[model samples]
Target: MDFNRKEMDLLAIKIRKNILRTIASKGTGHVGGSLSIADTLAVLYGCVMNVDPADPGKKDRDLLVISKGHSGPAMYAALAARGYFDEGILDTLNKNNTILPSHTDRLKTPGVDMTTGSLGQGASLAAGAAFADQLNGSSNYTYLILGDGELEEGQVWEAALFTAHRRLTNLITFVDANGKQLDGPTDQVCSLGSIEKKFEAFGFHVISVENGNDTRQIYDAVMEARAEKELPSVIVLHTVKGAGVRKYAEMENCHSTTVNREELEAFYQELDAQADDGGKGTGKEA
Candidate 1:
């Protein structure tokens, strides 16, 4: 289903709402990181990715890996919104025997392409998947999303080097430069200086999208990346930790939180307002 700009915006808002609701239902989850990547996830599933909800295991289909798998709620919300499974399953997140764990699991989830929870491994897995597809002479692309904090992992840089060395044009990476992590601001924690330049130094074609929360911009960047034939592309997206809902976005400790019924209702209402206002849900409120 091809979504126009407005449709994509609404879908992203709905996905953000779903993420909030799911976390709220569970009483606790990664709200900040998950909410921050809602727009990017929305664009991928709603516009950029060539995925079939009914045939998720199609060999030639595009793959997406969430490297910072703590943000699994965002991916689950996106998959559910895309009709990969019944949306009702969202309420069972983090529950016993539930498929929706804190991280993605390909073995348990219909739309998940890889099992990812260990921060840096998912990037390597994504690069490997892209290389395998290349070996099989398939044109499908592999998309991987990583948290800015995840860059602290040496394995992520190793995978980046491997991807660039192989010239895996079928692979695209996005860094959710949300500035904050489980502890505090990434710069304050570990100081990953010049993310785009780091990827460029690793021989990747890098693009920095200031408004990563804009679905149109995200779609355009993905299209541009897909057109590149010589290098793996990296999009350094500047984002906020808790993006959509005003309360969480402003909170310093929004990374993970216990939500009450009132908080959940407010979050949904804010999402609805943002959708109605045609706001992209990334900008700071006045």
Candidate 2:
């Protein structure tokens, strides 16, 4: 499938804007991690995934499993932009009895294929889903997104081994290696030595993108991962935790914090400038 770089870039910026708006509605949220994966989510929902907003559970459509469930705002933005639901619902995020929760839930959201929040369980669930699809002779792909810190879980390794053993080439996983977690920098918390090598050792066809905030790079990586037919694939995305917003991107504790609505207009102005410049500022590029 071919992608229009300009369109992808615009979509990514819009997703980032929506993320901030959604989190701001709740006063505070997982903004850092959510912003980190905006570009990849744009690539997937824009042209890669075979999902229908009108028919979300179509049998042949590609499925996405977000292991790092805290990043639901990004996914929700993509979904709303893709017409899965009205964008107005984003204001209900994390509110009582709201469909758009802080974490992804398949039952609560139209585009969410798997409900996840316990860190490593989404990996196992994605693996099992892929294995099931393999058994049923389905041509659909199961895409999984994991936070870099999530790799610290022993269960992630177990899921990796299972996917490798099963040879589930239809499954493609992405690691949002934004360098920070809920606590602090991933290295300071628990160094993950060479994420690429670790996945490679787990028998995955690993691909790394230096600038994960770039939509073009992320799209290319997905295409490359799709070409691998022998083993499961993982794309390690080296992204900025709060990309597209200079203020948050540079913060040491942007993981979960109150988004000052008074500052959103200024932030949006910056995003507009970046978009006009083809997403150059804020380290985001098409």
Candidate topping TM-score: 2
Off by over 4 Å in 1: 1-3, 280-286
| Pairs of residues at least 3 apart in sequence or in different chains that clash in candidate 1 | none
> Which lDDT tens digits does candidate 2 get at residues 1-286?
5798988888988898899889988889998889889989999999899889999988788999999999999999999988999999998999999999888999999989999999999999999999999999998999999999999999999999999999999999999998888888889999999999999999999999999998888999999999999888999999998888888887887899878778789878888787667666674431
TM, every model: 0.96, 0.97
Model 1's TM-score against the true structure: 0.96
lDDT of 1: 0.87
* Model 2 global lDDT (CA atoms, 0 to 1): 0.90
Query: Clashes per prediction?
Result: 0, 0
Summarize candidate 1's per-residue lDDT along 98-189 as a digit string, tens digits: 99999999998899989999999999999999999899999888999999999999999999989999999999999999888888988799
Count clashing residue pairs in model 1: 0
Q: Scored by CA lDDT, what does every candidate get?
A: 0.87, 0.90
